[model samples]
Target chain A: MTEILFYSLSIIAIATSLLMIFHKNAMYSVLFLLACFFSIAGLFVMLNAQFLAVVHIIVYAGAIMVLFLYVIMFLNMSTPITIRKSKLVMFAAVLTGLMMAFLLVVSVWQTQAFGQHPEIVDQNIGLAKTLGKVLFNEYLIPFELTSILFISSMVGVVIFNKKEVEDE
Target chain B: MNELINLKDQLRIIPLEHYVFLCIILFSIGVMGVLLRRNMIIVFLSIELMLNSINLLAVTFSVYHNDASGQAFVFFVMVVAAAEVAVGLAMLVLIFRNIKSVDINALNHLKW
Candidate 1:
């Protein structure tokens, strides 16, 4: 059952993500990316990280993607912008990505450290209560620091969007 | 106890390697998206995809090691990603206001 769920979700995620990347229209790409995020959330649930899954949906699909759509609409990108890149650059970019993937896969495959452990120690570590405890206790400092980061980023946004008053 | 066992059994059905490979594919797709797309928004979307793939890997390892730290770290990553998108979009809007284009190539010359 879990196998079925995993495979289906993985397929959906990869397909939608590829569609999101290759789609010409920015609006369609955003929608496709939204679908990809949903599938990733499903995968998170299958991995027993229910809380992370929920938060992923809320932060990513809810907040970020909406921001993306708003920006896209705000820019009024009705006409698809044409980017004329030479075919060689496109080929090199694809080759670079493939090489990176190949290297990562090879490295991961060679590392036997993670291969020996098939047994999960605690199945409930992903539960919110446990995660919350860990967050508030051991991760307390970093958790609080994120608020500072948020404040700074918020300030940065406001400042960046501030109107420039011209001197007469 | 029974539910815990069931959860373990369900998780065991899929190996950790599978998740790793899945993340790798997703990450590669993200890299390609960033590389191949000229639209600044799509590039940002691709970056999000890459971050998410890493988050999934972290959660997989966290579960494998019975550690909640990975999930906590993923939480921090999401926070950072959120803040990044906000600022990035704001900058993007500013750029658009100046040049009226989001094509990455449009800003090739910084003097614009």
Candidate 2:
């Protein structure tokens, strides 16, 4: 059962992400990416990261994708005119991506430690209660720092979007 | 009978290599999206996809090692990703307002 779930979710994730990249329509790409995010969330659940799965859905699928759709509509770029790049550039991009993937896979294959599956020591490690304890106790500083980051980002967004005053 | 097989045992049914390979595939697709697409919005989406793949890898390792800290780290990553998208989209909006286009090619004045 676990194997079936894992394979199905991974297939959905890979297929939707591929569609997201290949689809010419910006709106369709956004929707396909949303599907990809949902599949990833499912995988998170399968891995027992239940809290992270919920948060992933809420943040990526719920908030981020909505923001993307809004921007697409705001810019009126549903069907963007494709500026055709030369065949050479397209080939180079695909080649680079493939090379990167090959290098990563080779590195992983070389690591003998990765072949040994480690047993999960704590069954409840993914639970929110356990994670919250670790966050508040061990990671308190970084957690607070994230709030600072958010505030700064919010201020930056406001400044960037603020209307410029023109002198008459 | 199902209660006899705990969640941990069920999770162990899938090998770690499978998760790693899945992340690799997702990350590669994201890289290709950024390189192949000219639309700034699509590029941003690609970046998000890359971040999501990393997040999944982190969570997978966290579960494998039974470590709460990795999960906590994933939380922080998500927070940062959200802030990044907010600022990035705001900037994209500003750029669109000024240039009237979101194509990366349109901003090639510095490409001398």
**Which of the numbered candidates is closest to the native, going by highest TM-score?**
2
Q: lDDT score, residue A158, model 1?
A: 77
Residue lDDT tens for model 2, B36-104: 988888899999999999999999888777778888989999999999999999989888888988889
Q: Output candidate 2 Cα RMSD.
A: 1.9
Candidate 2: where are CA atoms >4 Å away?
Answer: A165-168, B1-5
Q: Which candidate is the best by lDDT?
A: 1
Model 1 C-alpha lDDT per residue in residues A15-125, reported as the tens digit of each score: 999999888899999999999999999878877899999999999989999999999988899467554378888888888889999999999899888875645467788
TM-score of 1: 0.94
Against the true structure, what is each candidate's TM-score? 0.94, 0.95
Q: What is the TM-score of chain A alone in each candidate?
A: 0.92, 0.93
Candidates in order have lDDT scores of 0.88, 0.86
